[model samples]
Target: MSNRSRPDSAGSPRGSDEAAQGPGVSAGTAPVGTVLVVLHQARSTPGRIGARLQRRGYGLDVRRPALGEDLPQTLDGHCGVVVFGGPMSANDPHPFLREETVLLERALARSVPTLGVCLGAQLMARALGARVDGHREGVCEIGYYPLEATPAGAALLPWPDHVYHWHSEGFDLPEGAELLATGRTFPHQAFRYGMNGYGLQFHPEVTREMMAAWTERGAHRLTHPGAQPAEAHFSGFDRHDGAVCRWLDAFLDAWLAAAPLK
Candidate 1:
């Protein structure tokens, strides 16, 4: 990552002026804009999603409020915001978690391009006045699982043959939100709130490295009650890699083009 690309939270609440330039200043040159990537843990880097955005000329300021860094008060200079998953639940009493939800509220209300992955999706749901809690009893999906897109989902998004899942908690559909996809174990797999805000319950941003790190650390959770082994999550990566990457690229390109950060 370039020094200007990955801004940390140590110095200031807001990033440097250079890091605040919004996206698409040039067609094929270096990325001129910045995207705020809210990371919950060190291991959960933006991975392939971040890489794609960078290739499209978007710099990333990856922040971790969990480490006592303050989140920016506004999205004035960011083209988009993406919150990655974590082991922590959105319902936790931690102040940082609450702040994350508040940030999501601001992002959605302002119509900034917003994406939430897994636990981040739960936070987005909470921000939108939805219930976020544990999955139904006897259902804990932890590996690659099938996602059935709704009619609306089929129309709006590409259908990945299967998406990777690791969450034990699921979200309820927020008021006025459209359910884009569903799973057998967890009904709410993906949703869209308003024009620019999206919440995905699966890890579309996962790369081989991120998956290895997660499985290595979360090995216990894989075989715990109602879960599959770690290998199940990765074995089909070879088969699913092409479709998944294409889907993410197309989805993100369309998403950014629809309503870029103002």
Candidate 2:
């Protein structure tokens, strides 16, 4: 399944699945399970997503295509696929990125659960045949921004009034997909394909440490430097973690329940 892969309930000891099942673990409960994680950038971390899934008992098989690592096996038997944020453009001279999206298309085809954040959302849109480009805003959106959930978005994600934004690129809603959220500059803040897939242009996976790391690494892009200076912004987060992860966890729980085990 991967260069390094294993599984147990996320809350249990790594090797306790088989021993505790008493040989009655059905076909659905494979001892070695995983959730394929596509790391789109150097800094993207799986904050609440990992925490939530760990509570529900699932492990991750991280795939860092940007770092030259090959993608793990398909989403079958895996809990789901989570694509993280990054600075690279999905359309910027890269095959691995496109390849990961193609794999996402396969996930969609099979109704496998997937959650894409920031650049991950754009790539997921592209994979679903949407038109994505950066020329719309022409400026980097580097902090917390507002989001308006559509009727569908409301039903699906129940997102708060505002969410964070960290990318310059945006996408046109793809065919057969529903737009979930929008902002002043980007109409495609979030999207969904069926019940099992989600695309979020904001960094819902970002925690305090992750945000601090991102700010530090991207400090070069910031001109001003001071306490609460005109640039650094994390004050608007508003603890929307419940709305964000609730919908995502629902997707993971439903799709993975039906996941095919090899």
Candidate 3:
């Protein structure tokens, strides 16, 4: 019943004291002890999440922990972790997938507060042993859609109740994991496991350009046999950039105030 794939990365390994110990890291301008952003693939950057944290005077660390990347070990040095989206499926036969999930598991164990988007979210679910698979119909939903956060999701609010969408696979809420939101197509739009960790099926951090960037790479998914692109009425992202940032800040503060890992 241990909810994790890689137990080794249980929590932030290098404490806040050691956060400044690393050499030649990408070194995002975020202050020391800000937050860690885990990139699943090159495409899935932190998006608005990183922008928000930087403005808040909090340091941001980007790492591909799945690729066995280095530095800023452990949750003690970070305010939180954000896992960005990716084209990869959670079930892919990649050892790095397992390793990434284990890191997420460790974050959960220490209540370090982690956020996973799309594949990032799926991996969170997978690490916790929930179901993660592609759409049988292969109906990969690109573009925007509304997400109705459940009561649980509201608890973590400033949530919009109805938000954006961008994934094909969905998950049944894992045991003790709160189903925070639901999309029309994907029942498991978002969830909160325990108190701090979050798994979101949607992409709240994406900008209009980022969305376009996504479409450029995965454009095939738009016309993928029978897939649906963002509707003509779908508009685009603009306002949510600030909103998601504020929400992320609150999430970090709440997690930190409740669990002091200094």
Candidate 4:
């Protein structure tokens, strides 16, 4: 099922190679490719990341299998795929999620650049043969937190001191995946599973509006054991928003540059 929303018009048409040199597009700096954005729910759409990518001259093909749209069988025409977070567990017995996992596996096998956020990251972990489930340890992570980057993470992208997070479950680092960032509650905060695939446990794509919607909708879950209050997540967003946005811009630029052209 597809959402009524469409890709930003500022971006060139999806998957057009000539878009790289199109008028108003930055010569040589912009990445020319269409990103296949997989949405699990209405609230967990790409948000800020989609806006940033449009400004960077990349088109987005948004799809929602939960709404009846078919998940692409191959990463044949797109340059990359990004799976956004949602409330559902990666292990949920949902047909759409099963299909999403398979699509992620195919994306990696084809060397297409792929990124996963929160539950999306968990899905990637499962696709790569790693374990993902609710936080077994009595602790759940919610709100803003700090991340200590590994040497590999620092070399790959600009690692901010802190990032906005709103997740209760985490995943074990997939086999052969490079550990990029770590947090106190969940050691596996970020990872790179393949040459072009990344998984982030936090919501780097979140904007203030997105956070508001989530906190309002999931207010009941915020009271879960060890879960931080909504205010805790909102109050600190201002302090970290600038740095996180900067890091996201740089990260997306690098990620898109690495995507193999189809």
Candidate 5:
């Protein structure tokens, strides 16, 4: 069956079904195959990533473990999974964080098409026995930063020169993972584990509304060394958003096509 025509499974929650249908889907249409979406905050939306998945005829099964929602024991009922960025660090001692780490481990082991962004990326790295920590110099990448795709990355897809970022910590390239992209401040910008698991330190999923919300709500983070001013964030978005959007579209297509590791 086509991805859109597949019936919704038990993995997808009722609220997520409505959210995924949005205005494009007919009221009586059968729900699509679900992509498990893990968010850190209660109000966190998957932003452009969620929209892209819906456009591809995949429904989102959003769950916020931080707010006490349980993650699935397995990814069998889902076509893919995405863990979005948040203010929390992957190194935190929270039980939910540990649970997410375990879930990521399972995703990778099953060779499920999985994506982890920012803290999600860090968590993936941590699950793979890599370190997730801040720069010793105390620098932050709270704005657009240049991204240099590695040879392996360029072979897979074109990458944006500058990408949106909103994190204080970065992850080390995990063992057995191929480094896909790099940046000066945080050298390990993106990596891939096996055939189906990917991690991105930048926020390609952020929308204009999400960017505004982040800059305003995370205003204090702008004061940190290496962070751009709020005005720069808007100006940078205007300058580079088109490339990022195009890159995200191509990347998602490639991501979904990835085969399970043999």
Candidate 6:
């Protein structure tokens, strides 16, 4: 798969070459701390989230533990952690998954700023001793769906009416975790474990190009019981993407502000 186009801070399309460079230090300034980005696939990039972090002046230290890349034993020198979603389940017996869960556990223990998306969210829930499993009816959420912010979530920030989803499984809200957002099929859309840790089941990081690629390559997923038609995905993007992007910007700001770099 080709590297998906991402938007720069100015909202212009950035080429794959530029995106491939990842986040780096600006010309003369000493670096703001780095955020450890954990991705599951070889070709996977952090998409909008990485770009947002770069614009905020934090360098990205991208790691793919699935491909034998080793994660740091600690979050030393790291300001935050973002674990992106993937095809693998958090319940899988893969050693890398176990390693990541352990790392997430440690990060939470240290009160490190952490954001988990989709499978990443599931991993966070697992680390907190919550169960991650498929729906009893076997329904999946493969496209855009309605999202309602709970009273607790609305107090933090406004949310988009609908958000993109692509998962067969959902996680139970772990003990002590606050449910931030909700959906029909997957009730637990977003949650906060502590002041610094967040888990979102939807993909606010998805860009238009990423959506196109996902729909094409994973077309079969649309046939699932609760999945949306491929065309609806594009329509949903046109109608809801602006709100989602705004929400992401606000959320990232709040997330970083929640914990000062240690």
**Local distance difference test values of all predictions, in order:** 0.74, 0.62, 0.61, 0.74, 0.79, 0.83
RMSD to native for every prediction? 7.0, 8.3, 8.1, 6.8, 7.6, 4.9
* Candidate 5 regions with alpha-carbon error over 4 angstroms: 1-25, 260-262
The pairs that clash in candidate 1 are 31-57
Give TM-scores for every candidate, taking all chains together and pairing residue i with residue i.
0.86, 0.76, 0.75, 0.85, 0.89, 0.91
Which parts of model 3 are misplaced by more than 4 Å?
A: 1-32, 65-76, 225-227, 230-234, 238-262
Please report how far candidate 1 places residue 34 from its true position, in Å: 1.2
Cα lDDT tens digits for candidate 4, 1-262: 0111111111223323222222333556645777899877543457677767667677778898866889777677788888877656787788999999999998888778889988778899999999986666755666788898999999987788888776677899999899999998888999997678999998777667666666676676667666678888877787888888889888877776676433
Number of the predicted model whose TM-score against the real structure is largest: 6
Q: State which candidate, 3 or 5, has the greater lDDT.
A: 5
Clashing pairs in 4: 1-67, 1-68, 1-69
Q: Candidate 1, TM-score vs. the true structure?
A: 0.86
- How far in Å is the alpha carbon of 80 misplaced in model 2? 1.1
Worst 10 residues of 2 by lDDT: 1-10
Most lDDT-accurate candidate:
6
Model 2 clashing residue pairs (backbone) = 10-57
lDDT of 3 by residue, 1-262 (tens): 0112111211212312112223322455435456787765433446555665555455667887555675354567676777766555688777777777777888888788688877788889988889887656656555556667577667766565445555667777787788877876667877888777778777666555555555555555566533445442144445344565466567656655555423
- Of the two candidates 1 and 6, the one with more favorable lDDT, higher being better, is 6
lDDT of 2 by residue, 182-255 (tens): 88877778777887687878765555555555556555444421112124355554455456555556644554
Number of backbone clashes in candidate 4:
3
**In candidate 5, what residue range of length 10 has the lowest lDDT sum?**
1-10
lDDT of 5 by residue, 103-184 (tens): 9998888788889988889889999999988888987787899999999999999999999887778899999999999999
Q: Which tens-of-lDDT digit does each residue in 1-262 have in candidate 6?
A: 1111111111113454224245556778765778999987756778888888877778889899988999998788798999988887788889999999999999999899999999899999999999998889988888899999999999999999999888888899999999999999889999998899999999888888777767777776678788888899999999999999999999999898889653
